[model samples]
Target: MSTATPPVSGKLFGLFCLASYLLSLSYGSTFLLSLLISSRGGNEHDAGSVISAAMLSTFAAVIVSGHLSDLLGAARSVALFGVLLVAASLGFALTPGFGHLLLLFGLLLGLGWGVFYTLGPIIVASLVTPTQRAKYFALLSGSMMTGIGSGPLLGRAASAFGYPVTAAFYLAALASLIGVLLFWRLDRQLKQAAVQTTAVSRISWRSAGQVLSSKAVFPIIMVGLGGCVFGGLSSFQTSYAAARSLDYSLFFLGFMSAAISGRMLIAGFVVKRDPFRASCLLSGLMLASIVMFGFVVDSGFTYLLAAVMLGVGYGLTYSVINGLAANEAPNGTTAQSLLLFSLSYFIGVFGFPLLAGKIIVEQGMGTLLLTVLAVASLNWLITVGRLIWRRLSTTRALQRA
Candidate 1:
């Protein structure tokens, strides 16, 4: 056989997509954990804290995983995260009390997810050119969304066996293991084929600083800010549905389905054309979703529409942002650049919900919705300002020339 690496065929790419889906299926518990905590006598605030804790831990892990990705290589780092997921899952299955669940569910699960999120895209980016990046990214994102959509259903089904909450974790662990194996096999095949992948001797604060200083930093921050709404929705959407007397699962289905449709059908075209424009649209949609939630008064149809809008907006936004960050990755520093992107993501995920949890406890979901809407609107305005600034600069340069 030729020593050259085999080209990534459509079939191989499809399998990778499948791997993405399986990996994401593990996230179904993200929505369930809050309810689990609440059911076990932890109040809504405490349940929100669990999500906040997990996201905060994820933020920390993404920062560390950047360096780890450089040292260990993307494939090995991903496998390591998978191992963490397995351990965390087993821990969740066996934990006897709330404190233990916090560690297992909040910390370890966050680490696993953080690494998986950090490296999976780098792996895919390595396999494609800058031009093909957005499309492939959308596919991977769509796959993950598919998994996220199915995760709750999986957890619900697994719960039928016994110990419903624990069963969800157990099932997630099993599914995560399968995903790891699939990814590992793909990695081995790529290595055997001698395909080049991201590798570096060391990464540190210095490298991260370099990325922070780059032009991409502003857009990355905008993308991350958009996630604040996502963080709020993740922690509260189910409860919000409950308050409105809408079916939680049904609402999520509409949301996830819209998100998937946006990614698979619409993201490629919009992101490829102008990521910034897509980001603006996504932020606007998020703001609208929050507005719908804030004003909801027993209209199931209105609630479902809001969910769908949130899903489509977030779905398209994430794919575009990831693609933008990937495009900005300076030679051999792909992982570090991506880490910056991940950091931005979890900042919103960690900060917004934590603060909103407090607001929800004190003021109510209405106040929380207003907060998200305000932040989202600000983010959109910032993106639009960036676009205008770039245009004005280009115009000035032309005049000077």
Candidate 2:
């Protein structure tokens, strides 16, 4: 196989971005899964458990997807997972009760997400040169946020039309089907461009494990913590809003809007500078956003503002840290680094909700928020520590010279 880097094509990249948007939209609609659980006579805890269980499958998929991509090729792997997502979404509509829903969504939908999320960036990395990677990554992130951000609106629109929440599942299914076809088309285009060679590689477990080096630890931890905050906030927003008589959609709208804009407008500038420092600043924003959501958000405006702060904070932070993860990888380990990054992130994203759900049920949203606040603060402190450490190391090296 030719190992030469493929020339980048704008049209191919555009197709990839469009597919990402649709795939994410399919996944994002599940942001309202908690409401479905409620309608099924389940509580917050059940919602958390089911969602977390589904995420467990996502975790498994992340691990398997690298090898799958290596074996079947990236585009084919993505298309395969996309098919699974479609089946899972349709299953959500046809399944009778909580147990069936759990089995289908948890295993199939979660697995699809794991593969899609993990491979999307790897494919992008292959398509772009190092100089163009950051900008393209930001654009890809923006496209995904647009789709994810639209998910809540899709659910709301369904309800407005008197369709049950399950209707959103069918919509997700449709989106996934379209996304799959796009990936298929992209695969054909890639073949014609001769960039198809860039997509296939042999990835091993031992190679994937190399991402655990010291350089990657900080970003991994920070993204994981961000996941915790996101998992808790997004997973239970329905109950949180209901308790306050506010609209949950405000949070998603504000979050996606700010996150998408931040990546488009600010991420390019920030990613070019000191990532650790930028991450520290963004962490502070995350901290404030959590506090605002927990304590200060009484009205819809406050809620939206809090979400926007979070969008600016976590959203941009994610991109910066992701860049760090890819950049800091030991040479030849970019794929492994990204896979590990996604795995760590899913752990926090899916793991926390299971716990937060119980906390919301037993102790209320206040306690959950406090817990998330602490996690965010720790993430900030760690980034600051990493920054300080880097500076000190540089100073010592100069002194030695």
Candidate 3:
């Protein structure tokens, strides 16, 4: 890897981390504001819907924007996305009514995030090689963890600052705006003629299908959903903590800090030894964390335990899944794969949570959690079964040859 790539010099990478940090911090703190809606008297579905709306909308936009970045180039797409994010933040600040404005903000923010979500990783990948990916990925993931962890602290800051509960939304928007400026600077550096670059194109559905038909990529996708399990679990931690009377903000901080540490601090160790085995091992760990979460009743220590377990799971699953996504990027399929990966992840993050919300409503949070555990086990089982089949087929082919 060339030292001159993105000039990780003098807070260049720090700025990239800052951009991501704001994205997560702003989004995570939304939970606090969501609680306000409930305090003012909203239903479970109402809050869930608002959260889901933001994720779902962002999910849709990211898939589209990510592919465009490949066709258009990471720097250009990033700067463009930054501009949209500022616009969306302003829109969010201006929306007056409940549900109505919430939905509109959701759309605008989603658009901004979609562009970013797509471009963030893509740009990072463009900067580093596969061997160096885990470290960079971990650093970026760590920033997100910090942002998530800061949710409660930021909420407290919001209060002391004498801002409205909705003020957190504007603050998040502000952070993202700052990120835009940082990314614009980075973009200028990346576009220079002196920087050696590789050209890549968007993957078409036909080619993507061909990649999917491959023995390795297909299995990776199913196994890849393990990444989503961590995502789904994180989605519910706020309610789980609050039900136990834990400070919602604190719960976020603890959970996020652990996860951030896992990614930023611990991920390199796992990646250094073996990215493939690390990935497989993380899947097993995620299953274990969910099982523990299913049975634990007292949160005094349970939340911390669960957070650590979940953090490890997230760090493991994401570290590998991200590498796999990068590896699976067929010669010209970078954007297409990114789009599809975002779509798959969003489905897991947004769609699974919506489904789980129903389970929470009918059976209760505990039951919903048990269901998540079952889903994790089941998802893992399916992956194992596929891998077993693939191994056997490979053995047979070798014998014939």
Scored by lDDT, the top model is 2
Candidate 1: give the clashing pairs: 5-193
Q: What C-alpha RMSD separates each model from the true structure?
A: 3.5, 3.1, 3.5
lDDT (10s digit) by residue, model 2, range 91-181: 7677766774576566787788889888888887776666556666788889988988887788888999999888888888898799999
Between candidates 1 and 2, which one is better according to lDDT? 2
Query: What would the per-residue lDDT of candidate 1 be over residues 1-401, giving only the tens digit for each residue?
Result: 22122246767778778877777766656676656666666655775676667776787678677667667666677777877777776675576655645654667767887888777777777676667777778888898878877766555566566657667777777877888887777776645432455565235778777777776687578767877877777666667767777767766787789988988888767875776677877778877777777775367778778889889877887887787777775666666787778768877875677787788889988888888888888877876887788899999999999
Candidate 3's residue-wise lDDT over 1-401, tens digit each? 46325444536677778877776655555455445555556545555565566666766576467456656666567666666556654554455544656666655555666566666666666666656665776787678667656755665677778976666667766876676676666775555421224454354569568567644364346433653465455556656767787644544555576677788667777777654456556667778878776777466667666667767776556766666666665665554565666556555655565566566667788887777777677656654665677689899999999
Give the Å shift of residue 259 in candidate 2.
0.7
Show how many residue pairs clash in every candidate, following the order shown. Answer: 1, 0, 1
Q: What is the lDDT of residue 245 in candidate 3?
A: 77
Residue 126 error, candidate 3, Å: 1.5
Q: How close is candidate 2 to the true structure, as a TM-score?
A: 0.94
Q: Which 10 consecutive positions of candidate 3 have the poorest summed lDDT?
A: 192-201
Please tell me which predicted candidate would have the highest TM-score against the true structure.
Answer: 2
